[model samples]
Target chain A: MIDPALGSLGAQIVLAASSDENHPPENIIDGNTETFWMSTGMFPQEFIIRFAESMKIALVTMHCYNVKTLKIEKSISDDATDFEAISEKEFEHTEGHLQTNDIPLNGTTATHLRFIVTSGYDHFVSVHRVSVE
Target chain B: MVKLRSRCLLVGDAAVGKSALSQMFRSDGAHFQKNYSMTAGVELVVKSVNIPETSDSVELYIFDSAGRETFVEACEKLWGQPSVLCLVFDVSSELSFSSCGRWLERVRAHCQGLHIPGVLVGNKSDLSSRREVETSVAQEWAQSQGLQYHETSAKEMENCEAPFLSLAQLFHALYQDRLQTIQNLA
Candidate 1:
């Protein structure tokens, strides 16, 4: 079972709303909790992850820090366009550790998944890692 | 082939030529505006400086914040754990020179007492006749504060790069010390 196989399956953040040299978007799929992709102090930040091939996804789990609301979307097309909303969550604030969440997708199949950070506990938010199973 | 990026902050009292010094260094002394407006918030400018005798370079993301007391509170949110500092003061204004301690305290407080490498700059050296802050006095204060001091004339575009270059070197030296410690641990 490739339980956390986003990075190993060749998924990458093809698009990001904000970019910081120190906290590049690639950290989201690096599968390392120590490194995270951080926002440069603004809201409505988003990043789109594209898998190498279309696959069945039963659940989407992630580790986030200071994130308040997160919305997940999926696209079946070849490109990362025309996304349909799957779920949105208001995270519980945590201190000294990340807020872990697993949103069930129920056997959804897609090539691209987009994660939108609508708001955050602080001015900036960090998405540590995301996995699909 | 080492590329490092760091956050650098410019803080001081108003009209101390912080913006002018930043522009001069960014443009390589080619552009010094005759009539410059005050910075209301934070302005970011990224520049790369190569370390001498090494292929490594540090990309300095300079956050030029407004010098006015009213705007400083809001500007702190944008600073975001600064790695280096450029404390500026006008040479002709004794009041501004005396406020250096306050500015330094604010920066250190925001950093949560981390060791931030930095340089103290006395701008407006062209106003030598009207200078109220002497080189010896400024140097002495900088030494007491554990910072190296340099004076520059932003209007005349002279000695503008010295302070920033010095800051880059200091950051590089700190990185070397950390690398050495890790190597010894290994």
Candidate 2:
């Protein structure tokens, strides 16, 4: 899912998508691949970590191929894991007015995956989809 | 013997004609001309539509949420309630159409582990000349996102009822399938 920030507003949007309905296997991911489309911006590292815990599998598409590839430092990948480590961390970093809850990790089979796609400036990665096997 | 009520949510960016379309459908020609001040938190309206085949009326509880970013939290409350979601956008606005991906992602993230049925709606089809989002582009995106897409005009009331009716049919079919499964188990 596309999260613009790590604040309550961003978290709220992510929560909304998770609660909708069960579309079915066919819709979840076409064939065997699920595409997650996202835009490039400053995403809260903690938020990404928390998102990984809930998802069985996540494929992040970096907006720009070249730039994103260059920016692919060890820190970004480390941050991905950092966010998933503690839900409270995400809650603490969010904007003041927004309220956040510790969403328990149900320990589902969903694997968290990442892919950076080109949106321009190879540094930007836009996730296209997430497929469940 | 008893009627079942299902809830539905209408979500999208501002000026997408969500409220206007809903008013037309719910009121049936009774015009309420007040800038309803953008659905602040979450506003709900209930209406019962009769199912012709079976003398039953399925009550529909619709939740309309504000499109502004500030109200995102309020919108989250309605997630994962076993309801059909209509993602509305303005046909004349490319930015609105492009934002669908983000909105869809938000819904998926919030309703974790739930596969919600979604319909992509492009409003303001009455102004054909000023259209910014092409029908083909919308259709392509809907296909990629696995959503049913329809272009409608609440102002003219053209095809306004179609989306709601189609969603009702989908819900009924799903309900019947579940009932059959239960009977088989019995």
Candidate 3:
């Protein structure tokens, strides 16, 4: 059986706004919802995920907690720059459980994806898992 | 740049200069309050220490608890699993120095045997004429407990920064080790 999660396809988080000892950026691509990358504090936290090669991504799923507003951008070049806005969503508040949302990417081809949390419902937020289909 | 934050619990008997030492380090040895009304509750002092030879830094949130036993019982609830410890005592008072064992025991019990690296600080070193605790004895005890020992005079702002700096560095070292472990897991 083949897993559809991009994490299983060797996606890696190359840049994160905050790198906490306990909750690291690596956790975002660990393919386990139980493990998560937590923001230390403040707003406008962002992370960039790099793929082995540019692939057609139609849908993106996220399991997050306490995140209010999120924006996504995609870059096809070798560098992480020259990105274009793909999708934006205002997540509902969740307590005791993760707020899971599936975002449509319209099958865009990209080598890197940037997820930015513009704000949070609380002082801190956690991104449990990011998968693409 | 691999920034980290840690909680440092400052504890000892009352009037042992825990506040003075933290204040001195926070202000870079600038202010030493001459007349201090004993801290009645838990006082929090935050300081940022840059680790040597690295761009990484550790933001130390120092919880300076009241020395009196009654307040300590209440302060214990606020500690919230301290990452490091700073056990202080007055070198001029043997009784205060003796209380070090009790404080250590209490912290050990509270942490449930978790190994939190720390330092043993002998404050009030300026009172050499009235000193009751010897450096050799304190050094031996600290070694037995696996803690680094340092003597400081908070009154004169002498060596007041060493213990806190050591604690920050110790925490930073721990973070580095953990970072390596996480990276290897990838």
Candidate 4:
């Protein structure tokens, strides 16, 4: 089965506080590794992604760059609020290519996923793509 | 000689030759990189345009932003406020041209209804055989959006300066108009 987090598979970016006309938050789920959603600036930037429907997720893979600390949260509710913590990790800095990492969810079921970028290797952090399996 | 500065936003869909056009304009047709790293974020390029037969000049801070939809929200924060807009699209791709409406709406919404002088640029004119957006159709749409339309080929450096130069002229004209109004009031 195809991952539901891919934009083509019906993942939706319900809310993004920062908006760049050229680089919208939709890039993270577009399923294109070459495209990305960049943070304009500051810490604690977050985006909410809603799946097509509630499904069990064993893992979530994110391809990003310059992200230092990432925190993932999930909710079974339809609305964006009431998120429960899933996992958080500090990424090692890498050069020349995107930092690809997977955060295991231990078979959690969620309708929405939240990614909070608490810090980054640089002033900005970009999320290229996100997938669920 | 009077000098003025304006922040000009270069916005459009990805792979529409925005970076190439900006680089060509900045380098005076002397530099066109064979390879371009997709602009991950905002790339700033400044150029001074001299008004013909006058010492007066306008300095443009061109913010060439990434065109992918996903990066737009982040890019808008970096845009701050812009003095002018240069909206671009690929003439060969109908999708790129259609996306122009969304780009313009997003920009206008960001500015909160303040009128910004802008132009619609159809890039990749060299690919005439593959063209999906015709000039008359594009011009009509641009007119409806309150913008002047121009076509360009960044690869061949064809008519690359018209859009930016037109923006500079419009800005200069506005400055002159404001100055005249003040003088007449005095």
Index of the highest-DockQ prediction: 3
lDDT string for model 4 (A1-133, tens) is 5778988888899987455444688988998877677654335679999999999999999998878888999999988779999899999987667888988998999999999987666534677889999
Query: Residues B29-85, candidate 4, lDDT per residue (tens digit)?
Result: 998877866887899999988877767677888999999878888999988656689
TM-score of each: 0.64, 0.55, 0.65, 0.57
> What is residue A72's positional error in candidate 4, in angstroms?
44
Q: Is the docking of candidate 1 incorrect, acceptable, medium or high quality?
A: incorrect
> Could you give candidate 1's per-residue lDDT for residues A43-66 as a string of tens digits?
578999999888899998898886
Model 4 chain B: lowest-lDDT 10 consecutive positions: B177-186
Q: List model 2 lDDT by residue over A41-121, tens digit each.
A: 211211121223333322222211111221111112413342122112111211212121223324333223222221222
- The per-model lDDT (C-alpha) reads 0.83, 0.52, 0.83, 0.83
Grade the docking of candidate 4.
incorrect
Q: What is the TM-score of chain B in candidate 4?
A: 0.95
Off by over 4 Å in 3: A1-27, A30-133
Instruction: Give the alpha carbon lDDT tens digit for every residue of B87-152 in model 1.
Output: 999999999999999999999986645688889999999998999999999999999999999999
> Which prediction has more favorable TM-score, 3 or 4?
3
Q: What is the lDDT of residue B49 in candidate 1?
A: 85
Q: Write the per-residue lDDT of candidate 3 for residues A1-133, one digit (tens) a residue.
A: 2324446677778899887767888878878877778765445789999997888888898988878899999999988889999899999986557889999999999999999998776545778788888
Each prediction's DockQ? 0.07, 0.01, 0.10, 0.01
lDDT of 2: 0.52
Q: What is the clash count for each candidate, in the order shown?
A: 0, 61, 0, 14
